[model samples]
Target: MNLEWLKGIYVPILTPMKEDESVDFEKLRKQVNFIIDGGVHGILAHGSNSEFYMFEDDDYEEIFKVILEEVAGRVPVIMGIGAIRTSKCVKLAKLAERLGADAVAILQPMFLKPTDEELYYHFKTIADSVKELPTLLYNNPRIGYTLSSDLVERLARDVRNIVGIKDSSGDINQLLEFIRKTRDLKFKAFGGKDTLLYSSLNIGAVGGVCTTANIFPELVTSIYNTYVDGDLKESLELQFELNPVRMSMDKASFPVATKDMANINGMDVGKPIKPNHASPSGVVESMRKEMAKAGLLKG
Candidate 1:
């Protein structure tokens, strides 16, 4: 209910899987501690980086339960219940509410996706389903769907619970427009791409929903803290330092590359859920040098 905590680095925490690709709750616990101990503002469980689509039945609930229990109100936890099925997404949103998540972030249905009007109704239905839980519309164009600023403005204006959106597009103009359109509505806008964190802040974005923070929480949080403290020089320096890792991981298979960076940093994040999802050996090797260059290595 308290949205103020949204204004910092909220990690889209990875769902660590065992060798058979079953969810590794133990390692997941360690990851929660790593980020919490590392001092991130919040956690976003089951995000794309968390491999939400790879999940089977009950997989979503169990993983989310682990995260909710581990986080234990230490900070906010935003449950991601994105699905290609509209009804299924609503069910997951309700589940998040029942489980006491502070909020839920929804991904617009991907394949056979929706028209803009359908998208509006889809989000509206979910928001109406759980009026008490604040919803953040996720706009990641990489997925081949985007939540335009106009659509977001409409959601912010029409849905009381639809209080914000996360714009993954690295385009500053889109982010600025989202900011401008929702400025008077008290709606929150978050930068979804790690590379745009600093610029997002300068454009009046409250914070970042970043993938890189999964490994380097301190770096992401430092950017937010420094910028908020009026230290533009240090903030820009930190944001600049994070770019290589962001770009490097992006070249690989999402959270796989991200998880590999965690291992490079000495955290045992295990491998990604799918074997083919693994980053190429060369990519992993290159990530090591890049992670080190970004000063994200453990110890």
Candidate 2:
């Protein structure tokens, strides 16, 4: 398969839960259709928003099965394999590959903070172990461990199967540097921050894995499409219109606000995983107002 098929806005879809905290498969199916209908290029199952780390192995398998059946080839599905150990990650990756996932997105091992060399070997081993399956590196400094540009370049050069990166560090300069340093390499680069989508596209980044797209997939897709269509002015303006909701949502826990926005838009994506504080009434009200102002929600 063409690795470039993974390009464009990929939503790290949230796992909506029932009141008893079980995965709401019916609601999730609606969510998948909603995102596909809204024009996202692909969907990422069990990323940060999907609470992949919080789930047990059996739960992940079940959720993946549901996602695969729901999507059913409507669009490509990139599975998230963010296990704490590389062995478990490889296991999940193999499962995803066997189940016909388009690609696997992995974050660096957290907590232990492996050295650059360790990190390199970790990814190289996973890529090698997975063989032909394309892998995308997920770099989010806000989460704790940061993948350095040098290591990223090294991986791109050494690991042919490692196909792309999702840079969510929120630093446009760092993203630009990643693009600059890795330009000759075959790996695709994507923006992870919603606010920097425009600049990321301008600087040769392929697309985005944006949380904001959960609520405004069309608008986010418009930003990318407009830019690619050479309407930089319109794309930038859409980004400006989207900035308020993006900023507000970032101020709170991620999938919390994201699911709320999805619910407001008539998709019944349920609550975030436990231990996350419930979104305040005022915050939801403000988000509603901002969504209206951004034209994402009708008055």
Candidate 3:
């Protein structure tokens, strides 16, 4: 387990595309720098929020290359190597390693709902295939798959490269279970929800890999830092301040709300993928007003 690079808030960035659906390299670069400059500890390109499943192999390769080049070591680039097929995941993992990604975050195989043993084999197979790079298990149950805390412990014990787990289950009990069960191991656990950030840390989480960080990087990072620094009151206050923005996500498709918020704040991260419509203008305006009220946006 590579515990050294798994701490603090890691922003799962949204993929910016032009109106014609081409990859917007310029905006992509700007967005990367935006989050890094805003104080995020790491950038995760092509994760769920980044439309990882929508991209082809070539598209992923190109995006990974651009992200690695733009990030340029300012922060670790954690590339999403999640795929429906283990073989393909391994290929992407190897490509990420070659392209200079600091780590690879993989989601469990969706649709099939593999058994605990099968899930273990799936991750172990990929981890074995990519021995040189660290693997962060992404347990996002909302997306159709869930990795149990017991399975996480088993993986941590068995797979040498299985370094961390991101619990997006939104269940504090599950998050705490992972923390408690894996305490003796070298594995790292992170809260996957923006709302659960404070509690997750209170239970011994290393940090967070949150979609909300796409818009409120400083506030999110502050929550993690303040909590780690022992200022629980300030951290909780900041967490509460960002709740509306995080809750706004439940009102629309993911990256859509997140990307719109980014553009409203002046980052212009292009548009969401097809079928995932950008939020309505009214929703955008309301979010803008909320952001201003929260002091996240300048007048």
TM-score per candidate, chains pooled:
0.96, 0.96, 0.96
lDDT of model 2 at position 194: 91
Clash totals, every prediction: 0, 0, 0
**For residue 157, what is the lDDT in candidate 2?**
84
- How would you encode candidate 2's per-residue C-alpha lDDT over 195-285 as one tens digit per residue? 9899899889999998878778899999999998999999999999888888877556756788777777666676777887558878888
Q: Which pairs of residues clash in candidate 1, taking residues 3 or more apart in a chain or in different chains?
A: none
Give one digit per residue, the lDDT tens place, for model 1 in 27-47.
999899989887798999988
Q: Pick the candidate with the highest lDDT.
A: 1
lDDT preference between candidates 1 and 3, better one: 1
Please give the CA lDDT of all the candidate structures: 0.86, 0.85, 0.85
